[model samples]
Target: MKFNWGNQHKPNLFTLLFLYFLIVLIVPLGLFSAYYALAGNTNQERYLMRQAMNMTTGDASTVAQALESYRHKAYQLSTNPLVVEILKADSLEAESSQSRKLYELLFTVMHGDIYLASANLVSNSGKVRVSTHVFPEVDDLRYHGNDWDMASIINQNSQVSPTASLISIQSHRIAENGRQVVASILRRVYDQEGTNLGYLVVDMYADALSPQVNSDHVLTDMLLVDTKSFYATSLVHPERFGSFDRFPALNTLDGNYTPRSLPSDTSIIAISPIRGTGLHLVGSLSSAPFFQSMENWLSAFSTTMIIGVVLALGLSYLFSRSIARPIKNLAKRMREVEQGKLESREVSSAISEFSQLEHSFNVMIKQIISLLDLTREEQAKLSEAERKALESQMNPHFLFNTLNTIKALARLHGEEDIYTITVKLGKLLRSSIDNRESEATLEQSMALIESYLTIQKLRFADKLTTEVYLDPSCKHIKTPKLIIQPLVENAIIHGLEPKVGSWNLSVRVERAGERISITVGDDGVGFPPDRLPDNLDELANSPHVGVYNVYRRLFLKYGRKLHFSLKSKEGEGTWATISFPDEEAIKEEMQ
Candidate 1:
């Protein structure tokens, strides 16, 4: 009995092909995808960094002009005739009468200035004479407690050499509306004889200094910060108003920086000084959005590679078994024939050569073929389902690539409008695709809608006016991502675009206690008065895509807690409002 060592087993086929497929397909593709995604992310982040810097400078200049104007206004208040008379009063009765006149004058100064929290005339004795709000409460020490000194901080921070620049805006807690955080603009008031008469303190809502020019939501956590004290005006993040030293990474950032040298983990910051204001317009862009698509692409591609490798292993095993099994059977049959028993042993296969071996073998071949056919049918169905899923995921990729190509062409020809539109389109796609969460912060939803409106505004130019008024307080409340967007889209598309005259579209999110109301309205061609559906569920069959979709999704997500309404008149415009419990509000209640 001799044993053939070489024929013991041929381990080459399955193992070799498995390694070959992985090495040939998976390794190279993985490397290429990783490298491509990394490079793409880097380039994108660099571009954002440059754009942020440029925007930061523009914003700084705009703010500088505004602040300088406000400074002149403050000086005007100090020199006003009524203000002077209040300081040079003949007696207590005279001062009292003058105070009333000055008080009325302060209200006049703040009449149309919505940002003016208060205009206080602080006397030399540190007594507040008159203010836009309650004069008595304005002088209360309880508000500016903790021994906070107005004159000390102002005198120390004021750069009065060239001209008296109102103390660069400071984070002041005044006794207006429960001592709301406002930026203080203090100017020295004087009598005719040059006797100093306290300071004229004009409290502007911190929002005045907060960044609002950024239509591109790339920047967040913006601040107009004092260089000396780091007292920041953070409208979006009010808690960050007092001091920024708590944010180690944020505080230590240089006078300015770009993403080129920034670490991946740190925020890409752009800073520009507001001239003569002693403050810097600092804006931060998180690395998340810039690199999210790349990370997602790599993760998805890796998953696909894994699936392919697994399928390759199954294929390799099938090929190996198909070739090795039948040959083993044939060899055994030849050994039996060598013993003079000529009948061939049965074998099963789909190979052409084995089909003619024996009748039973042919029958077995037919059964195997039928089984293979059934398997292939099932496999086909699975592959189809998988392909559809892939197509759904690949849609954004195709559209995004197309947008990039269009943007390049637009830039080449210097088509500013087209380029801007394409850039915004890309932003919308990236924002939608990058966030996979079913729920998002209200602020996130606002950003997405804002991006959409921006493109539409560009298309309409001056003919269309869009205003987004968001209660800074409700920004963090949770909501469905596409919840409010479709409504806004409907306003511009269905309500405004078809109108005969100038269109005005507004999206307002107002917080009322624990709940919020989201309203999207337009002054354009509206549906007939009777067309406004009382029930959105019944309108599933209707043509109102935006309102219907929003209603359905919100109803499904929030059940009866969410109330969606649609109202319109043919001559007037339409208003779609969705009101629901603020998740944060509910949580607070529970707590």
Candidate 2:
């Protein structure tokens, strides 16, 4: 069970196009939609939380300023000489007169601010001497211990300098309202001799100290929490007082303005600290409005994503079709060519590359058809030539008889060299005129070349020299008949015949790796540098018929597999080399 990739079925262009669109267009759009959904909701939540914090900070600042003003007034009243004298007076009349003066001082300091509930002056012994509200009895003042602790107030005053003041703010229950929450500011009083006398206590409505919500954000709520006593003033629920720790979320925030989610409701809380006061301002808002807007945006985003996917799929189909149709037509034409139809057909396309490919394909088919017709004509000519060659074979016997007669005459005349030269000439002629075989062994081709060169040696007399070296390993390899002899003839006629000095001609054959090479070299007056032909056609038309014939025969037999080249310079020797594959490889190729 071997897996072949060539045989694997491939997905069609349409399915591939759809998948590409789904990945590149639809997936990204879906991811963007999800990101927008999450990010949009988060941004809205942050914006709403920031608004609530800003409102809470403004309201806290205003309330803090009002509380600070009251604190300063309380300090001034405590330092008043008449108020101090009233606390120190021994006689009832003197106390009453000083008390009247203290009341008038309180009136001057309060200036009819409705937030101030009452202002009272109490002695060191825990007795209220004068008050803007009804004066509480000593026992009553003590019983309302949480409202104003006289002992602690006196002790705190005693530790302070006479010229300075100590102020304390606390949440207390008012007697008249039966545990209604109020904030009290108590400042220490001093006498002329710097004696610690009593305290000036100012009670303010806690509602006045609570942060106010602006009209623009009525849904928002602001709360002021006393971190020390755990008391709180809430804008949303003004009645909520006492320990704010009951709500664990607000309690856990400390005093930093960080927003947190509340478990009790769909609201978020942000707390900010008031500077110079141990109070935290908390802002809270519901998440309903932000959620509504996010829902609407998600709906619109989903609709847009759906439309985008549809559009992407449609465009992908059109794009893939534009590319696939031309390719399919080209493939169909190629299949026709595979079936041996070499007729040309036009395939036009708008794309530049496709148009060029179509033109090249048509031109290629025309060239193939032309080449096949030429090949058929050549085969007909070759068959006619073979018939004529068979008819001429009877003439070789007459020539062989004449060469034998010449050999016998030379022997009778006692000229042994002439007889030997005649014998070699006979062998060369026989080899050339024979047409029974188109191919000859390397041994037979070399023997034919040796005989031809022997004839040339006699013609040139003492001026010509020749060398023939053939490797024993390549002696049995088959090659075209008369292939080597023509090249040797060309060297003798064109190279050695015209040379003045001693001419050298060498023929060598050897195996080079997987190839066999036959080389013919000559030192002679070479052809003019500019007179060499560029191709076989030009060479064939020239006077060098032997070289052209050998080249044409090798090309027809082996095509590009035969390596043949001729190189010469004007004054240097010329070299001709013919190389072909080893015997086994050549046999395989021929088969």
Candidate 3:
């Protein structure tokens, strides 16, 4: 028996075609299928989050409705005229033991829970006539200590109207134990002519409110934080009192709704404010499940991808021996090219598709070499052009002599102001022309504005008062040099100088994220409504030279990301806004 290399060398076209179909079509289709699978999983996760948010919001609405219901019932019981008449009768006199009669009647009629701990009547003379809860002592009936506080509260609440009303956290004494419970809603009992008789207090219990948050199990911990004392009604035990400054839920706090990290290793929080009460209800839950779902999805996708890649490799090998041999030869040739040996190697195959691939490879190698030579020539041309542009701009000696001659001529005329102005102008122009850099720190721009204002002040005199406000954090921020001066010049010459009263010129710099804005405003007669341009081209036109120049410079520096806005009213004031992207924005341009 002998091995035959001649039989192995034979090529088949159909097998080569099948393997090519698998590489070019089937493999890409598999990748596309995987991408859509991942996308579907992502959408599913988002949908689940949305459903959770909706459920949480629904629970919040239910709680609010319950509180409203409690408030309405309390209001109805508090303002009943019969209740008021009895309390007023008790206040009038002892009246043959009639006070005791009225007390018993009141207790009998308004007895039982009614979802409240107790409902009671109190008189203006600081007496608790009757209460559903028993009195611990005679002083409890007196209620003398709470009269001033409760009366003041009743007097100030004007929103409480003719029928019934709610007071915000009424301070009341529960005479039985003198344990003060903060009441949420109260009603004033009045006479027929609306004279102050007494008040009916509906006592809601601290423990009774527990049912308001029945879905606490859904979240890790649910809490109610009152803005008044920053106290919690239902927080994790032992740490429920005082401000929740250190609570894990506070980490999730944002402008209103925030996410906070919990001490428990696996929790995340979502917090939102309760309306009217100014209390915040925070819900903390574990994110491990959400993350685990994502991980499992990815793991499944990775398994699928591995299966697909293995099937593709096996199919490429199994379909045709002739196609596999040519591919192996092509890979060897690629390795030769990678090793800096680009001399083309011939591939022998009777299969048409494999033969075509061999021909294409030879053509591609020749084209790549041609492109390399062309790229070298283009690089040389770009270098020469840059060098010539640099050389054409140099004439420092002639520039200095010309500046000196101008200074001499201005001084000879005895125009001291003009001479001083020319000197500063020359220095400014020289720095601007020589620096050529696109960016400068805010300090440099501030110095430029100060110098420009000095010259402008000499011309405008007492007509103008200038103000500059810059955020301390923006001191190191880089901006275009002389950017602010152009805006100030526009405000002074066109907006302020022509007006009467105080010609106020204010410049402000505000930094936010990867953007900075400089605003220059003036309390001057503003632009006529019809004269303002309708589009950006008009804003950057020659008619508004100073504004236009700055606009153009900002456009060159930051492109579409640099925003410009102008607002002016007929007689009130004018504002010119210049906004540009920061360093982070510059990096985005590269990408």
Alpha-carbon RMSD to native, per candidate: 44.0, 10.0, 32.7
The digit string of per-residue lDDT tens for model 1 on 371-449 reads 7789999999999999998889878778888999999999999999899889878878786677567788888888888
- State TM-scores per candidate: 0.42, 0.52, 0.38
Higher-ranked by TM-score: 2 or 3? 2
Candidates 2 and 3, the one with greater lDDT: 2
What's the lDDT of the predicted structure labeled candidate 1? Answer: 0.69
Stretches of candidate 2 exceeding 4 Å from the true structure: 1-219, 234-264, 270-281, 305-449, 461-463, 467-491, 499-591
Task: Please rank every candidate by lDDT, starting with the best.
Answer: 2, 1, 3
Kindly provide the TM-score of model 2 when superposed on the true structure, using C-alpha atoms: 0.52
| Model 1 alpha-carbon drift over 4 Å, by segment | 1-34, 90-100, 126-128, 136-163, 169-171, 210-217, 252-264, 302-591
Query: Candidate 2, after superposition: displacement of residue 237 in Å?
Result: 9.5
- Tell how far residue 39 is off in model 2, in angstroms: 9.8
> What is the clash tally of candidate 3?
4
Q: Find the 10 residues in a row with the least total lDDT in model 1.
A: 255-264
lDDT of 2 by residue, 229-325 (tens): 5566664565655566655557446554443433224666666666556566776776776677689878888888888888888888888787778
* Clashing residue pairs, backbone N/CA/C < 3 A, model 2: 257-271
